[model samples]
Target: MTAQALPPVVDAETWQRRLDELRAREKQATRQLDAVAARRRRMPMVEMPGYTLEGEEGPVELADVFGDKSQLIVYHHMWFPGEKWQCPGCTGFTSQFTRLGFLDGYDARFVVVTQGPIDEALTYKRRVGNRMTWYSTANSPFGAAVGAPAGGGFAVNVFLRDGRKVYRTWHTDGRGTEQLGHTFGLIDVLPYGRQEQWQDSPEGWPQSPTYSRWAGSEDIAARYGPDGGTA
Candidate 1:
């Protein structure tokens, strides 16, 4: 489908009034999000067992991932055993989180874990120029415990360390994982707003087959690679 013409021009006063109305809603949404976060902080945590995963240097325990920090966030990347490539959706989500040195400042660490072979994961990491730590749980039950079993979907898991013990504080999947990507946040502000068929845009606005059209495009893979090159 093609893009529709721009919205009709309106006077500055009308524009300002419309923006002010939306700004109120935005503020309300922000407060609602803050409330959710507050509740998340209070959620009870489960103790995590001594699980081992394969890293670049070899097998490593789950607690080791936290480094000297007390917090860890792991992206359960969906990479099934024997698959030639990792999940594109996971890659897209991770592409937004490569520069994670800032998390160190907060005494936190982030890592990507998959069920695929460690060598394969490393190859993809190098090809995509990922800077965050990565590990493979192919020989462990880490993926299943985190709701990302073999051939399963993506998830983000948060953990807290108390001395030598580790506890799972929170986990989220599906739309909840969207917080990791800025693209959707950026798209929501556009005039056409993602241009997805499901969006409630005005009549004649461009619309396409949601994520399928964008994910199936070769350009997306190319764009995710180094220097805008193909992966």
Candidate 2:
């Protein structure tokens, strides 16, 4: 299909009427999402053991991750030991939350957890210019419990701290994690809609392979030194 064969242009009155119809559905969807979130808040919680993780300050316990806060949000990053680079999808997802300082005002702490070596994790952190806290879950049960395991996948885990004990309050994976990045949400409203072959775009709309071209740029690759150091 060609660009000239795209959807026909309509008059202003027709366009507004169609947009209004879509807006009504959008509002309904928003309310439905809010109702689902309310139900999520009422779900049962699971006790999380004192799992150890390597932090910038050395080995730290899961409770320590909260850092005087009552709630903790962990991004289960997919970086395995011995991999030359971290997962690009995980990196992009994390890059969206680097400046989430507002969570502090609501008594919440967020951190990225990975199974990679501490040194390599730090190097990737610098290369991506991340300002958020990152910890290595190497040799820890945190990854498996959170659904990321030792291979490659992304997940978000929420926890609540009571006194010295920590409990997993909620968790989400798959498309549920899409809410973390504005890029996906924003593109979702566009006419082309992510330009991915899987989307239900119009006949003539453009589409490409999804997430198959995320290799780090040349400048970013240069940040890693000969010894795999981000100096």
Candidate 3:
């Protein structure tokens, strides 16, 4: 069957009412989310098994990486085959890590773990100029053992440790970006914004069909290898 004809455009006053309704619905959703976060915070404690992660100073235990911090957030970064490239979405989250002072105040640490060669990971780190730690799990079984998805995507995991071992409390998609979306932060101000490809945004929103690496006049192909861009 052919598609139905579109509805006529609403007047300005009607549009304003619709926007107010949208905002109200969003507020209710935010309250629900906050409640869920409170529940997650109460997750039972567990021990983190000791494993050496390849850090800037070579293999180091999980507890050692967190230093004196009480909590650890790990980003399981995807490393696609052969191109020596990292997930563009993962890189986007890493960009915000340096600016996060909440970690210090809350006794938490954040790090990105990838299955790429150390040199490639280090190069990506330098290119992005991020202060957060980046390490390799490509050769290590730490990622898979802790339930890394086989589909090769980004996973944000929150861990708590009791001495030498760490326990996972939460693992989520989209890098916990939903927490910052409503307040109109830097990500929302960007040309292609963050809610990823699944947002329920209005028509004519400036969502790119690909990552922002090629934003503006930059040539990403020469720098990020053949599999770069939306391919």
Candidate 4:
């Protein structure tokens, strides 16, 4: 990298002036996000089927997953059967959400629902030190109905409960779920930004292939295993 292309030294006033301009843009983006969320709040929801899922304790109904909470968020985690581990992207993404007790105050519950068997799913949960509660849709078509069929990619789904009935309000996959994981947002604020080739980073800033950092990352899971990401 050429020294000239690096982040240039600037007087404090010049830096603050540039920062003020960026802050204006940031605030505008925040307002736009609020608008999107407002629209989301008004979106129509579809009533869901009453399906039974396998929780760690045993079989559980869809509404029961909410545990008296009025709202539900499910991460349709991708799984590969007979393997010692599951999807690393799903693993790393879900791992970032631990001790999410604050959601209780909002009358909401968030949990993992996968097509993998309950036994193996829980095993992988402990293996990765993921702390989020997990459940299995191996027997029912729950995962398939909710956009994460067996052998498919990952997705995030939201639902609302009115008494015994459950309704799905929103669902998203691919990059749409990025907002839930703060790791990317935090990394993005850095000068280099995710450091991935796809990013529009400044010239001469560090860059790498997407997901290159996660390659051969079992040791990371092991490091978190004791304090635990845990069943």
Question: lDDT by residue for model 1 over 28-107, one digit each (tens)?
Answer: 99999999999998999999899999999999999998889999999998875655455677776776775778887899
lDDT of 2 by residue, 1-231 (tens): 455336668999999999999999999999999999899889999998889899988999889989989999899888756665666677766766647889879999989988887778887787666667899888787889778788858899999999989999888898898876787887787766677777787787878788644435223345333333344
lDDT of 3 by residue, 53-140 (tens): 7888788787777888868888777777655345655555455555667778999888888877667777666655546688877667
Of candidates 3 and 1, the better by TM-score: 1
The runs of at least 3 residues in candidate 2 whose Cα sits more than 4 Å from the true structure, single-residue gaps closed, are 1-6, 213-231
**Ranking of all candidate structures by their TM-score, best first:** 4, 1, 2, 3
Tens-digit per-residue lDDT, 175-195, candidate 4: 999998888888778777777
RMSD of each: 2.4, 3.2, 6.5, 2.5
Residue 63, model 3, lDDT = 76
Name the lDDT value of residue 159 in candidate 1: 96
| Clashing pairs in model 1, backbone N/Cα/C closer than 3 A | none
Total clashes, candidate 2?
0
Pairs that clash in candidate 4: 129-229, 129-230, 130-229, 131-229
Scanning candidate 3 in windows of ten residues, the lowest lDDT window is 213-222
lDDT of each: 0.82, 0.79, 0.65, 0.87
Q: Which of candidates 1 and 4 is the stronger one according to lDDT?
A: 4
Report the alpha-carbon TM-score of model 2 versus the true structure.
0.89
Between prediction 1 and prediction 2, the one with superior TM-score is: 1
Q: Which residue runs of candidate 4 sit more than 4 Å off their true CA positions?
A: 1-5, 215-217, 227-231
- Give Cα distance to truth, residue 111, candidate 2, Å: 0.7
Q: Judging by lDDT against the true structure, name the best candidate.
A: 4
